[model samples]
Target: MINVGLNHFLIVSGILFSLGLYAVVTRKNAVMVLMGIELILNAANINFIAFSKFGNLGLTGQVTALFVIVLAAAEAAIALAIVLNIYKTFNNVNVDEIDHLKD
Candidate 1:
């Protein structure tokens, strides 16, 4: 039998955050950057839920996590819309290639 603890959650969150950061920094595609950002947000939610559970913080963590989910959704929608518009305007979705919004 194995027991999971706060440390395990923290480690998972840390890995997620690191991966997200890497993606955001290294990825040239706009969509991939957004995905990385989502990963970072998820890592945060995991931390919040884990702390809430271990610290007996009741619904606070869960509520915060819910808010984060909503925020992430909204962010993704708006960002994807922007990316689409950028794609339409520039015909390219690479963040590095699109240097200027106006010509």
Candidate 2:
């Protein structure tokens, strides 16, 4: 424990964002892709909160971060529901295999 600081938070956020991007690009599973997107969003959220708490941005950043967290939850729910519907229709959760949309 090296007494986490602003730089530490930034580094963690960078790593999280990179890993999330890699997972999204390398994974073929729709659910995993969605999870990676969520991870990226969360990494950004962490950065916001860190700057809000440790930096001198005051409460504005905190309020914005709160809103972002709420939106992230809502987006996750809606996206997961859509992914479930896709899985039900295709019997698979692979993003590249979802092209049989009939009218």
Candidate 3:
């Protein structure tokens, strides 16, 4: 039988964070960037829960993770709305192309 430890969870979270960073840096589309941000937020949540479980923090970590999830949801909602408005105004959602304030 194999036992999972904090190190294992940390490793997974690290990988997720890295992938999220890559997506955010390399993707030109605003939606992809938002997805990457979500991945990064999820990675942070994983770390919070893992550390809370391994440490002596009781349910604090879990509560923090829940708060993070709520914040991420709200952030996504607002960001998507802004992106939709941007698209409607510019007819494009490419981050690189939407550089000018004046259209």
Q: Pick the candidate with the highest lDDT.
A: 3
Comparing 1 with 3 on TM-score, the higher-scoring candidate is 3
Which number leads on TM-score?
Answer: 3
Cand. 1 Cα-lDDT: 0.95
Residue pairs of candidate 2 with colliding backbone atoms? none
Score each candidate by Cα lDDT: 0.95, 0.87, 0.96
Pairs of colliding residues, candidate 3:
none
Across 7-91, the per-residue lDDT of candidate 1 in tens digits comes to: 9999999999999999999999999999999999999999999999999989899999999999999999999999999999999
Q: Write the residue-wise lDDT of candidate 2 on 25-74 in tens digits.
A: 99989889988988898899889989988988888777888898899899
Name the runs in model 2 displaced over 4 angstroms: 1-3
Residue 101 miss distance in model 1 (angstroms)? 1.9
How accurate locally is residue 40 in candidate 1, as Cα lDDT from 0 to 100? 99
Kindly report which residue stretches of model 1 are placed more than 4 angstroms away from their true locations once superposed. none
The count of backbone overlaps in candidate 1 is 0
